[model samples]
Target: MSKDINYLIKSSIEIYFKNSQIRDISFNTFLPENRNLKSKRSKLKMEKEGKNNLRFFIESKDITAFRASINEIITFGKIFENVLNLVE
Candidate 1:
């Protein structure tokens, strides 16, 4: 593998949810999946640790839109990268 590929593999993150609240209806399927190149949403894997496991439920709440347009999103990312200190 290329050095870049190795670096990318090492920088990857894993996100696990006890139960996903991202339903099909809530998603913009046609917009495009895996569009962001920053950090992609990992495939979720669930396990039953015990029979008495607490459940995570999505409360009645609304998600605000991106608030900014696509160009703004990219601009914000670049600005954040320039100033924000991210810890590995």
Candidate 2:
């Protein structure tokens, strides 16, 4: 893909993070490890975009795994948001 497409994707994901409040201060401090993993049927990568931004790139061999990964991420985000609310 071109740079513009890449930028667009990153921007969109960042917006989701912003709106979901997933990039809160506490979460940034304990960000996931920045690495890429490949399995027989999928790939997963987590990277820090900048000082306070994280990017997750997940690829699966099939749509089912892809959807599952997405759901898990969304669920994790919701749980984290709730925890932050509780702490504050």
- The per-model lDDT (C-alpha) reads 0.26, 0.51
Candidate 1 per-residue lDDT over residues 12-73, each given as its tens digit: 11223233332221122212322442323122111222332311111111112121223333
**What TM-score would each prediction reach against the true structure?**
0.20, 0.56
Task: Give each model's clash number.
Answer: 0, 0
lDDT of 2 by residue, 1-88 (tens): 3323221111113313543245555345334422223354445555556556666677665655566556655665677678868987
List candidate 2 stretches off by more than 4 Å. 1-39
Which model scores highest in TM-score? 2
Candidate 1 overall lDDT versus native: 0.26
